[model samples]
Structures are given as structure tokens and as C-alpha cells.
Target: MSGASNSGAALGSLLRQIIVWVVFAAVVVVLPHLFTSGSSISMMSQMGVFILFALSYNMLLGEAGMLSFGHAVYFGIGGFFTLHAIRAVNDGVFSWPLELMPLVGGAGGLLFGIIFGSVSTRRAGVTFAMITLGIGSLVESSANMFTDFFGGESGISANRVTEVTLLPFSYGPQIQVYYLIGAWTVFAALLMYLLTRTPLGRISNAVRDNPERAQFVGYNTTMARFVQFALSGFFAGIAGGLFAIMFEIMTASNVGLIQSGSVLLMTFIGGVGVFFGPIIGAVLITYMQTALSGFSEGWILYFGLLFVFMVMYAPMGIAGVIVAHFAPWRAGQLHRLIPVYALAVVPAMLALAGLVSVIEMGYHLSLAYDPSQPIDLFYMQVNVTRLLPWVVAVVVLAVGVALLKWVSGRIRERWNDINKTTERPEAAR
Candidate 1:
């Protein structure tokens, strides 16, 4: 009877996961058609790029337990190749379809991965991270110095309105690009997830947990690291290619330390232990950047603070926090918490938007104009007002945030109580 019950529970869990995934896929597929707005589509496409980048980073940090500081080198090189491929396709030197441009990035990543992995895989832990950091810095400095290839600070741009699109759609249309990106995002995510189930994937975990134990069990730890690193690079390259295609531009910024660090933040904030955690992190971080960076000069500082807090308080990430509540969400307790979660969304969004606006206004003042430019707080456009509205906004934001925190705390307590009750019997057993 116990065996039968366990099998039934496992089947139910699998069905729930499958259903959730299918719903998410359907939403992604239908979103472009529903929105039809250029800006919306473009933002969605950018999200897809970040999703790929974050997932690739997770392959190393999550699966292989390798902390890479130079992952951007592979991604940047991939972008460069993607741009070149676009140029070649446009100039008739190559006869590939526009949809296939990402392959160029993938191949570039694979080539560089093999070269770097061969050396870096010899060392693990802090040594490996330092080596990658050094390599990344070297590549970035070379990019700046070699103006001939990298186009200096101006970067390189490619025309996407080419004659090579596989479908009847034009690349100029944002909706069409969104669909393409959405498709690619799903495909790449599926591939990466499948990879975690392979023999190499299993060995990667072994190497991550204890290299010495893996060696004792007759595994070549170096070989395992090398393969995993190379694979991670390949995925990062694909992400870079997606970025190039979406933006139609590639710059040193794409492959610099900042870019690599951002990917790390996304993965770590998402939940390194959970497969879908990084994806959630990518989407949240990307959205925050897009929404907040425009309003505040201090956005980076705020982001840094948030990251530090997460590292200290919620090391498992936002997903981990959510999962903690449901414990075994597959058991169906998650459904009960939906109302409480939904209740927190509105106040949270309002508070966040207010904070972002204040930040953006401050940023605009610093970057664009001095004290001469009139600060605009409410509407966000340039105005002749002084600091009165800004002061009001700050107070409002503070109060709103405090309220949000209070409400969230209550919800969390309730969730914990329910979860504790559910787990008591299992613990006693």
C-alpha cells in the first residue's frame, strides 16, 4: 500500500510540473501576438537573451560548482562572431538564413571554451576563478586596444533587415523578432535542462561535491571540469548571439567583467540549487534593470546592496524562499498560499515603481545636466521644479515600503505555520 501511494504521488508531481511548464510555454508563445506593441516585443526579446545567459552561467555554478569570473569572454567572442556572421550574410559572402546567425556565436564559444578549458580545468575552486578573471580582463583590454577588430568604444552594428529570414516575417518587425526569440529561449532552456540528466551532468555534480572522492571512484576530475566548462561556454555563446541579433550591435560591454558579474548575480539570486531558479532571477533582474536604471543614478548602488542582502539572508535565492514555504509543493499545498502571495503583489509593485522613479530622476540629473536642469519627480519628464516633489516621493516610498514589508511578514508567518503543521506527521513518523 505504501509503495502504491508513493508511485501515485510521484506521478501526480510529474503531471503538475508538466502542466505548469506547458502553461508557461503557451503563454510565451501567445504573448507576442497579444501585445503586438513594438516596445513590449523588444523587451521580451531582451528577456530571452538574459534567460539564456543566466542559464548558461548556472551550468557552471549550479551543476559543476565552478565559479567563473571570465564567462563573459566566451559570450563576448560569440557576439563578435555573430556580428561578423551578420555582416557576411548581408554582404552575400555567406548564404545562411537570419534565423541561423546564433550558430555562429555557439561555434565561437565552443572553440574558445575548448582552448580555455584545457588550461583552466587543471585547477579548481579559487584558483580556477582567478584564472578566468585574468583571462577575461586580458580579453577585454585586448578588445579596447585592438580598435581595428572591436571598433573601439563605438562598438559594431549590423543591419537585421536582410534577405535571409526563414519565415515570411521580416526581422524589422518587433513581434516577429519576439516570436523568434521566444522559440529559441524555450529550445535552449530545454536543451540545458536535458543536459543535467546526462552522464556528464552526473559526473559534474560528483566533481562539484568532492573532487577527491570522484578521483577515488576512477573519474578524471580534470576531464569532467573541462567538458562542463566547454559546454557552459557554448550556451553562453548562444546567449551572446541572441543579444547581438536582438540589439543588432556588439560592444566591449558585452564581454567585460561587468557583464560576467551580472550573469553571476542573476544565477545566484535565482537559486543555484534549483534548475528553474536562474530563469526566475534572469527575468526579475532584467526587468528591474530596464525599469530602474532609467530613473536613478544610484541604481547600481541599490542593486549592489540588494545583492549583498540576498547573499547574506537568502543564500538559496528568491525561488528557494518560495519553495521553503510549500516544502513539497508537489503535494499541492502551494495552491493554498496563492491568495496571500497575490495580495502582496500590488503594494510591492507600487512601492518599487515609486522607488525606481526617484532613482531615475536622480540619475538623469547627474548624467545629463547639473543643478540647472529642473528635476521632475512625478511625471518623470524634465520640469523646472526644485526638490519639493523629490522629498515627498522619498517619504511616500519609505512609508509604502514599510507597509509592504509588514504585510509580507504576516504572509510569511502564516505560510510557515501551515507548512509546519503539514510536516509534523512526517517528522514524527
Candidate 2:
């Protein structure tokens, strides 16, 4: 009876997981159909690109426990190769479809990863990170200095209307591009997940947890790291290729330190220890970049602060926090807390908006602009506003944050008490 009950519970859990994934996949496919706006489609496509990039990044930090500061080399190389593929397809050098060009990017990344991994994998920890950083800087400087291969600072551009699309659909349609991105994202994600379940993946984890122990157990740690790093590069390259296909161009910025840091932030914030954490981080960060960056010159500063908070308070990340609440939420025990959460959201939104407005105004004020074209604060457009709104915004934000903190503390205390009372004594035993 016990075994049967355990089997049934396991089956139910698997079914629930499958259902969740199915629902998510359905939403991804259906949401774009509901939006006829080009900008929305574009944003979704960019999200897909970032998702791939973040997941690839996680393969290293999450699975291998290797912190890389120069993973952008693989991404940039893949982008460069993708641009060439685009040019070739446009110039009739290859008959392959536009969708197939990303494979070239993946291949390029794999090669670069193998080469770099050979050297970097010789050491671990800070030494490894520093080596990767040096490699990244070298590549970025080369991209800028060498005008021929990199196309100089202007980077490279390709015609999107190439004859390489397998489907009889025109590449000019935003919907087509959206579908291409969606399909690729799913493929890459599935492949990466499968890789995580392989023997190599298991060994990588063993190596991460204890490299010396793994070596003593007869596994080559260096080889494992090299293979892991190379595979990570392959996926990162695919992400770069996706970027090129979606935007029809590649620039130094695509593979620069900023790009590398963004991927790191996404992976770290998503939860480097969990497989799906980076995906969550990628989506959240992409949304913030699109929605919040335009609102503030201090956006980077805010992001830095947020990262610090995550490291200090929620080291496991947003996904980890959600998971921590799963038991109570899943059992419907926390349903009564909805009203409190909703109440907190209003002042929070208002405070955030006002803060963003002040930052946006300050950003414009720093830029030398003509007084003839006035900026509008109400419209949230670029404005040359004085300090009055800024002062008012600061005051409101402080009060709202204080209220939020107080409310959160109360909620957490109640939650802990409920959990303590409701938890089974036998379960604890």
C-alpha cells in the first residue's frame, strides 16, 4: 500500500509538471497571435534571444560552478559568423535558408569554446575568471581595431530578405520572425535540458561540488570543464545568431563586457543553482531593460542595488523565493493573503513610476538639448523638468517603501505562524 501510494504521488507530480510546461508552451504560441503590434512581436523575439543566452550561461555557472566573465567571446564570434552566413545567403554563396544560418553560429561558438576552454580550464576559481576576462577584452579590442573582419566599429549588416528561408513565407513578416525565434528557443532549451541529464552533465556536477574528489574517483576534471565550457559556448553562439537574425545586424555591443555582465546578471538573479532559474531571470531582466531603462539614467545604479539585495537577502533568486513559498501556496493555505499583496502593489507601482519619472527627467537634463523642443513629463517622454517633481517623488517613494516593508513583515510573521501550526508533527519527525 505504501509503495503504490508513493508511485501514484510521483506520477501525479510528473503529470502536474507536464501540464505546467504545456500551458506555458501554449501561452508562448498564442500570446503573439493576440498581439498585432510589431513592437510587441519584436520584444518577444528579443526575449527569446535573451532566454537562450541566459540558459547557456547557466550551463556553466549552475551546472559546472564556473564563473565566467568573458563568455561573450563565444557569443561575439558566433554573431560574426552568423553575419557572414547572412551575407553569403544574400550573395548566393549558400542556398541554405535564413533559419539555418544559426547553426553556423552554433558551430563557430563550439569551435571557439573548445579553443578557449583548453587554456582556461587548466585552472579554476579567480584565475579562470581572470583568464576569460582577458580573452574577452582581447576579442572586443580586436573587433574595434580590425576593420576588415569586424567591419570596424560599425560592425556588420545583412539583408533580411535572403532566399534561404525553407518555408514559402516571406522573411519580411514580423510574425514569421517571431515564429522562427520561438521555435529556435524551444529547440535550444530542450537540447540544453537533455544535456543536463547526460553522464557528462552528472560528472560536471560532481566536478563542481568537489573537483579533487571527482579526480580521485577517476574522472578528469579538466576534461569535464573543457567539455562543459565548449557546450556553453555553442549555446551562447546560437543566441548571438538569433540576435542577428532578429535584428538583421551585429555590433560590438552584442559581445562587449556589458553584454557579458547582463547575461551573468540574468543567470545569477534567476538562481544559478536551479535549471529554470536563469530563464525567469532572463525574462524579468529583459522586461526591465525594455520598460525601466527608458525611464531612468540611474537604471544601472538601480540594477546594481537590486543585485546587491538579491545576493544579501534572496541568494537563491526570485525563482528560489517562489519555490520557498510553494508548499503553502500550492495547498491553498495562503489564498487569504491575496488582498494584502494587492494592496501593497498599488503604492509600490505609484512609487516606482514617480521614481522613474524623476530619473528620466534627470537623464534628459544632462543631455544638451534645444530649448525650442520642450520635453513632456506627463507623457513620460524626455523632459527638462526642474527639481520639484523629483523632490515630491522622493518623499512619496520613501513613504510607500516604508509601508511596503511594514506590511511585508506582518505578512511574513503570519505566514510563519500558520506554517508552524499547520505542519504535521510526523512530517517533522
lDDT string, candidate 1, 1-429, tens digits: 999999999999889977877886898998877867677777778888888888998989999999999999888888888888898888999788878778889899989999998998899999999999998898888887988667789888898778987888778877777777778788888889889989999999999999999999999999999999998899889888888888888899888999999999999999898888899889888887877677556768777877997998799998888777556476567777777778778777767766765766666656765655765555555442457657766776787788788877878787787778787878999
Report the C-alpha displacement of residue 106, candidate 2, in angstroms. 0.4
* Worst 10-residue lDDT window, candidate 1: 376-385
> Which residue pairs overlap in candidate 1's backbone?
295-359, 295-360, 296-359, 296-360, 297-363
RMSD of each: 4.1, 3.3
Query: What's the TM-score of each model vs. the native?
Result: 0.82, 0.87
Candidate-wise lDDT, in order? 0.84, 0.83
In terms of lDDT, model 2 sits at: 0.83
lDDT of 2 at 274: 78
